[model samples]
Target: MQALRKYGDPEYWNKRYSTASGTFDWYFEYHPFIAQILDGFNSKEISILDVGCGNSKFSEILVSKGYKKITCIDYSKAFFEHLFQEFHERLPSVHYMYMDARMLSFPEASFDVVFDKGLLDSALTGELSYVNAKQIIKSCLRVLKPFGKYIIISHSDMETRKEHFLDPSFDCELRCESIVVTDNDCHEGEERLPDLTFYAYIFSKHLH
Candidate 1:
């Protein structure tokens, strides 16, 4: 586990994406589950911010699904270059920027949706994980417009990893949903690999 702890480091991600070939979403990309996960909100016109977006084609897929005004941020310059090159002309609606999730440069109430797929989990792997994660969360809340949504897809359970989001100061309605990802090898009702469970923590800000 010590070796994997480096995931929290920006340099680690820089190195990782430097040689990366194709897209990589931390867990699952936008597919059978992404549409279902996003169906609850049901608005393609709203502005979306995808934090720590890495090389994931999730944002691209969202564009294909008819959602415009998507901004993706990552601390890794490598990812910014790759993502920009891959979609700049193809999908001009999606913007890629090099920025840290913990200190978003955008003004407050800038977006309608703030989404993170596996950034918090990566931060949780390093030292002062809680501090970093909370900083990111606070920024997410601050930059969201009233009644905006903060969606986090993580492997962490609610009992431990997500209880911190309930501090009242966050001012959001918290809900947890579980998604079961079965192995692809399961053929015609046969189970092969153990089920992998991922949690989606949705935070909808209160209008003041």
Candidate 2:
């Protein structure tokens, strides 16, 4: 629990992301297929909320591809202040705000899509990890427009994250897919080369 406390602190994240050398995307970088998923939502008119937006360059990619309304929110104000200063010229369209994901302040049905990359992982480390994660998901659901997709990329398998969606408490539909990566760097017949895979969960908010 104490571990969760330390991680949930805004100051901790601010410090962790303050150094340039320390900045790196968690787990995998934005995959090309994910980019294709974004491209499918063409019309260039969708609003995206990147929850727990740390130092990842995902938003920059979205902006480069002409995504007009991209908002990145984190609890750490200092981290975003630094990011804003760093990418001001390139991210005029990106809105960086500091807010806790468990208690989002947005009005209902405010976003077309809400994305979470490893936010649940971080929340899972806390004392009330499951509870916190539920709050975060429900909060995200509240802000998503009817039929909006909440895409979460995580290293956690179905055994871990599947329960939150299965509780019957959330009014949403869920689908999860595993991402397989074939490391060509390894020999073709290498015994150790099993699929390098992870899971991406997508929850669709039901229209009331």
Candidate 3:
């Protein structure tokens, strides 16, 4: 928590997203690891909330796959506006909201699936990385139904260790389901070169 007090703030993330110079601006569409995780589940009527979902192309994919309830949240209004303008009418099933992932105001056990694509990693980039990560995770857990899944795509190996800390609070098992090392030359010679290997963690709520 002290780390977030030192660095993880809305301004920091907003600025990071606002800059076109950052790698985030050149993020790839449809996270493969998240797609794999979702493939493992068989439920049809799933409620999914994608945290820090900046210009998420994943929403379009989900809509094409017939997902009815989809919500995406991002802290930056500018990014959200760009996303909305691009996809608002194209995919009406997607509900976009502007809010900090750490301070989500939703009822407990509200969603069937909570997926994050590098949201926690962005929070952890600053000094209060750990605290911000925890805050987001807690909010995710709060909004996840019992036995629901919390999927996170993080660049750091510490997410597994951090999950142990959250076990006491949420009674869930955080398992590292997959690691996708992408050399997707989709943007060859682009200004931003993707260098990180993303790890997908699936945190399943333990039913009593």
Candidate 4:
């Protein structure tokens, strides 16, 4: 169990992405719900920050949709090599940085939209789970503009994940909906993996 603590370390993810098979997207990409996620927002105008962007191609897909000013930050730089190799020069248009989600370096109210696809869930499984996960969410709120949207696709249920967003400490209003997603991408066993259902949480920060 002590070794599992490395899951929270950047080096562990760096090594994984450097040697992982193919291009992987945790909890799938945002292609299916692009409209729902970006509802009432101009994708081309709003600045987006994808927190804990691993090897996910969601940012690339957003770029293709003409969403300029997309920034992806991950703790590991090793994934950058795979990104550049897969997307070529097009990736240069989207900002990529090696940064920690729990302690973002961006200024307050810096982004209009932030996406967390499986990031919080992954964090919850790591060492000091509650502290690490709460810090990430708090940092997201701090960096997000008033009325900005934080979209999270997590494997955890609403009961488990909602408290962080609804906590009195944070000034935000949240709504969640369940989505049935196929886990065929998971290769855990020979038997077919069950169709997994999870929640899509959208938390809009109240104007201060």
Q: Which has the greatest lDDT?
A: 1
Q: What lDDT is obtained when candidate 1 is compared to the true structure?
A: 0.83
lDDT of 3 by residue, 42-82 (tens): 75468999888776577777888778889988888766544
Q: Clash number for every model?
A: 0, 1, 2, 0
Q: Which order, best to worst by lDDT?
A: 1, 2, 4, 3
Against the reference, the lDDT scores of all candidates come to 0.83, 0.80, 0.71, 0.79
Lowest summed lDDT across 10 adjacent residues in model 3 is found at 19-28
TM-score of candidate 3 relative to the true fold: 0.76
Better of 1 and 4 by lDDT: 1
Q: How do the residues 1-208 of candidate 1 rate in per-residue lDDT, one tens digit apiece? A: 6986999888898888878866776777754655765665678888889999887888878898888889998889877665467657777878888888999999999998888999988998888888898899998989999877898888878987755677787878889888788677568977588878898888888887
Clash pairs for candidate 1: none
Model 4's alpha-carbon lDDT is 0.79
Model with the higher TM-score, candidate 3 or 4:
4
Model 3 residue 89 lDDT score: 71
What TM-score, over all chains together, does every model reach? Answer: 0.89, 0.85, 0.76, 0.84
In TM-score terms, candidate 2 sits at 0.85
Return the lDDT, model 1, position 127. Answer: 85
Q: Alpha-carbon error at 178 in model 1, in Å?
A: 0.9
- Candidate 4's displacement at residue 53, Å, is 0.7
Candidate 4, residues 1-208: lDDT per residue as tens digits? 4665776676788788887644578766653564566757845778999998877788878877878889988887777765545644657788888798999999999999989887887777787888988899899989999888888888778777766667888768888887777755556666677776778888888876
> By TM-score, who's the top model here?
1
lDDT of 1 at 136: 92
Poorest 10 consecutive residues by lDDT, candidate 1: 30-39
